[model samples]
Target chain A: MPDKEKFFEQIVRENRDKLYRICRACLADPDDAKDLYQEVLVKVWLHLHTFRGEAKLSTWLYRIALNTAILYRKQQNKHTPLLPQHISELPDASAETAHKQEQEVLLQKLHYCISCLEKQDRLIISLVLEEVSYKEIAEVLGLTVSHVGVKINRVKQKLALLMEQQAGAEIELDKADKR
Target chain B: MNFEEIQKNWQTQQAPAAEAKAGGATAESDLLVRVKVLQRKVMRTNLLVAIVISLTAVAFVFILRPLLNPNTIWYDVGMGLTLGAAFALGLLHWFKSMPWKKQVNLSSKAYVEQVLKKLHYLNTANQRLTPFFMVAILAGINLIYFDIFWNENIKLRLVMHIMLNAFMISVGAISLYYSKRHNDQSYEPIIQELEELQQKLEEV
Candidate 1:
């Protein structure tokens, strides 16, 4: 393979999961996430020549990925209201152990909570979950490091509240089913 | 569950490796082809617009001069200024939208800020230039025909001159109003979003 092609493939291999996770977190629909992921990769490939080594490749990827995802969401919003997927609709975890199954369920709940966030919040939280440093997140988002920290705290608190509400609603539903 | 647990699980979950690889290679080539096609289309369109505008400007200068007898120097200057302004504006637009400038590889924030700054500058420049260009063109056309009204014996010449001036002025005014309104409507939201993003970044 040519040098550019090899470079692209290397970047894709290293950051595919991060890009997809960011897309998936921002968009509720898996199909949309897939489409956006493909779009982001294609964009990255096309602009690969512009990668000046001033920032880490991952940071550059995050910038493009986040911008594409945000723009995609805005375009999608014009035609339809964005709705978070119900937790029941999530794919079943095939883990044999109960502990793994519980973890999978919690992960799905976390995804649901993320999907409920506003666009910027979703992006900030997704990067946080990816273990991106606060300063990097700030650079990726064009915000100050201090602002990124505050936004992350606010987004985490919001997610905690959303998860609690979801748990409460599930408990009430369980009681109703017993009745 | 707390964020740490969610984060741990997020890291551990399997990425769809096979699917990503399969889809990515095809998508990359397909995107390259699309980009090439788009670049060709834009170049073709720019060439076409330049040809059309050049032809129109030349034709108008020649065609309008013959309509008046004993044409004055103002007519020549007016026509020259009008067509010159039109061509300049057309070239400015083409240069602004050229594909080369769109490929900056800056960090996300810097990239967004760069784009926003470019857009703001373009919007402001276009807004400032449009009315002045329109008025100059209109004045040029009127000057080109000024001698016709002064020297001609026919009532039709006066009537025609008045009617043409009225039509041009009305069209210019209406277009200026709509163009400004449209620019504001289209750009304000994006500008607001970028500013909000900036503000979020700046929050201490």
Candidate 2:
């Protein structure tokens, strides 16, 4: 086995990217996600020895990263004051352009869909988006391969339902705006 | 939306720079690196503990041994044995209770449950064992005082002290043996429970 410090450094260097992705997905804010990224790295460093190889390291890192981000966001929301609508408006007018609106709508739908998932379901979908394999997911989550497949299917179905609902709402909003 | 559309939409968006994955290694290498890092830290901690225990044992034998009253050998031996057993038991309990190498695949629910279990185990184990061992030491001391006051032949006293020391060693050894046994028995069950929890999440 490699010396502890060297081994931890190598792990940090290796997973720094994936950890960031996890933070980005969870936090949805660049600066907050960056803070989450560093926090996850520190935790991984501290708890590195606790990683038994029963699950893939990616799964473990994902778990830690997601949990940390969620906790941080929960804390932030409790303390931070919300901005007024005018003050919070985007500086880049391009961000509100018609082309960007469509993308934002989709992103908003995706976020709402994800949030509506059961916590476990949400985690699985997030990991799936990261392109984790069923076997690795199973290992990380201690699930059987077949079980992961079934659960993932359920999550997809739920997401599809959410997307459909969002689409219906968007149509209603457009009509209301015209009226 | 179709997979292609969804994929395309997602691909077009750029996550913030700090949250981006630029040039990263494969997942397999990442896993290997993490495991190696953690193993090294644990091994170092274990080594440090072993050294401390060795030094403490040496001090007990060389320094503390001669300072006790001549009549107190039995008391010392009994105390040592009881302490040794209790310490062994405590360590074993802690090792078993730790979530180290536990299935990291806990869905949020399972993770919370595991955390609760860990806390409960720590509390219950400490509550049950610590007091009992303290009582055991008190009993041992009482037994020694009775023997010394009631039957005071020097030769018999020596025999009693030797016997008490032997008894203490036996207790310590027994505690250590049971500690190992308890750990072995619990390992598979812990892994099995974790596996089941994972399956539940996967089926979600």
Put down candidate 2 lDDT per residue, B92-197, tens digits, no spaces: 5548444554544322334535643553454455457645664565465545454354447777766766776677667756765775575445433443444444
Backbone clash total for model 2 is 4
Q: Against the true structure, whose DockQ is highest?
A: 1
lDDT of 1 at A44: 82
Per-prediction backbone clash count: 2, 4
Where does model 1 exceed 4 Å of error? A78-85, A90-100, B13-38, B41-204
- Model 2 gets an lDDT of 0.58
- Fnat of each candidate: 0.21, 0.04
* Candidate 2 stretches greater than 4 Å from native: A1-17, A24-35, A49-55, A66-91, A95-101, B11-204
Candidates' DockQ values? Answer: 0.11, 0.05
Q: Which number leads on TM-score?
A: 1
